[model samples]
Target chain A: MITIRIPTPLRSMTGGKSEIEGKGASIGELIEQMNADHPGLKDRLCDEQGEIRRFINVYLNEEDIRFLTGKDTPVKDGDEVSIVPAIAGGAHD
Target chain B: MFIIPSDIWEDMIDHARGHAPRECCGMLAGTDNRVTRQYRITNILAKLNEAELARFDQPKLSDLKQLAPEERADIAFQMDARELSQAQKDIRQRGIELQAFYHSHTMSPARPSATDITLAMEFEHCRAALNLPQPLHVIVSLEDRDHPVMRAYRIEASRATEVPVRRQ
Candidate 1:
């Protein structure tokens, strides 16, 4: 079982549940399985090209999956995945 | 140029002042580069965890001492994700569009900085791909505290153009 943490923005689609448990071999399959159960989530998480939205960051046990293997990143029992919105914009001066 | 009524403009400035020393942000709904209404969203960066964030019924106190000196020193804005999503829905239900993004510059000038340009570019990228209208960036600078300066701009991938602000 994989524990996926949902960001606050998409909490409404998840019925206000912050975390969900699902089973999948990879991150991609987990997203698919979750979307199958809860609609409108995949669209917000992935773009039309099936890529993660630019502002959304997925972390596997504190490691960014994007810098590692992206959607193909493996998942296993007791693994924790966090979806965080990027904190951008500041005084670059 | 964006058109904002004197009352609405004053309200935004008041919001900026209320959160002085720490940047504040809110959403504006309207059409055609003119603002009709505004919704203030809680800035969540001051919190340290999601559980603390979930307790929205409680008031949030942004104690500068809680953050590192550097983070406290910088003028940045981060809206609570849930509040932002709800505000979007509210705008849609009102039959209006999110015409502008508003934030404050606590100690700096009323100008879009490099970081603002980058974030605006990302938003423009998504909007352009979806064929949506780009929203104006409204910055309220409280450098003088008593005499706040508010300005508007259109930010693209490379440059930011100042848009004239006028009373409606």
Candidate 2:
């Protein structure tokens, strides 16, 4: 199980809880399993291509997973995952 | 509606003025719909790295790379990602909510443009991510230069409705 820190914006979807625990072997699986438990979460975080939307930042512990392996980044029990909104410019995504 | 203290309101204007043609972006943290603390973040408008882009994903981004760095910031603004993430953690630690996101419109009106509207709507899709019925985006327009105008907006579902910004 991994500990995921939910941002305030996504809190309503999580029943207003700021943090929750879920299961997954990698960051990708974790989002799927967590979405199974939370519902609609994976959709908010992942796009149709199964890629983490560029406007959404996912951090594994203190480092943004983008700088690492992105959604493919492996995860294990007790790891911390934090999701926050990223604002971008130019035409919409 | 968003209530901003006088000092913070002035600071936002000053931040916009200081940046001039370049857009200035930051976050506002507070309780309820009133602002208490303002964070001035470094705008990485023209500092995007290749990792952040995927194959000329957005035409504007690709076009942005064509402009001279100084002229680049004028077309758009994006806050430094690491700084924003760190700021969120700090804001949470202080027990205050991040009430709104703010930026300057150096050449346009205080109202959101199509791209700004799209940006806000993209943010809106977070599903009440801010725990507010609509996410608030405050824009300061330096179009007049001599008289900077600021306005508040509630952006959702591709719509941007003007909300009063009171300087208390």
Candidate 3:
């Protein structure tokens, strides 16, 4: 089972669970499984062109998936996936 | 010339403080001496790895200790092209001129660092119209709110000017 960490903005879709477990041999499969389970998360994860959005980053065990094999990056049981979106706002006075 | 609003400047300072220990980068935008918009570009903190941090040199204790003040100031205007391009494009698309690049100097004086000066110099070299009438370099140090220093300068002649930038 691969554990997928959900970001704050998308947590509502996952019923507020910070992390969810799924079965997949690769990043693509993991996302596909997530979409099947969550129903509306796929659209948020991928843009209209089906490409990953520029502001969102996905990491497999702290390593950016983009630097890996991208969507084809392999995953195994007990692997951890983290999703982080760039945050904006706030400055010191 | 673009002017950054006080509120936005405050927001940027807050963002910088929140990301303390690492630098925060963003774009400043405005038209004709006023900055109406600001975009948080990226968090450099998110990109650093253990190996990179291990090799990090503290600016306060670096070879800068042996350099003349003028030489040290000159080094602050250089910046990376890719980062400049990203900032420029973001501002341009919004119909705002690329006024200045702003970043926080966490754990250090709010003054422009050697890296900042290098970026400013690079920007002046790559951009056309050196004769354009506007201040291209802006440095804001959030150390003291009452007298938060905002210095403006032209990168070509290396002349400094003091301008009042109101933060809301």
Candidate 2 Cα RMSD after full superposition onto the native fold (Å) = 7.8
lDDT of 3 by residue, B27-113 (tens): 667777677877666544323222222112245224333445333221222122234345555665677676655665543454444
Candidate 2: Cα lDDT at A14: 93
For candidate 3, lDDT tens digit of each residue in A10-65? 77899988789998888988989999999978777765666555555676775667
Clashing pairs in 1: none
Residue B41 accuracy (lDDT) in model 2: 80
Docking class of 2: incorrect
Best-fitting candidate, scored by TM-score = 2
Q: Candidate 3: deviation at residue A56, Å?
A: 21
Q: Using Cα atoms with residue i matched to residue i, what is each candidate's TM-score against the true structure? A: 0.61, 0.67, 0.44
Error of 1 at B33 (Å): 1.6
Model 1 lDDT per residue over B1-168, tens place: 789888889999998888877788887888877788898877555543433222221122143334564464345666655565556667777888887888888888999876677666655643432234678888999988889998988887559999999877
**A1-93 per-residue lDDT for model 2 (tens digits):** 788888655777899887889887789889988898889888777667887754567888766787678878999888988786666443222
lDDT of each: 0.71, 0.75, 0.55
Report the alpha-carbon TM-score of model 2 versus the true structure.
0.67
- True-vs-predicted CA distance for residue A71, candidate 2, Å: 11
lDDT of 2 by residue, B1-168 (tens): 689999999999999999888889898989889888899988776554443433122566576777776676786777766667667777777998778888888888887766677556555554343343344788998989999999988777678888988989
Stretches off by above 4 angstroms in model 2 are A1-56, A60-85, A90-93, B50-59, B62-66, B127-134
lDDT of 2 at A28: 89
True contacts kept of 3: 0.00
Top-down TM-score ranking:
2, 1, 3
Better of 1 and 2 by DockQ: 2
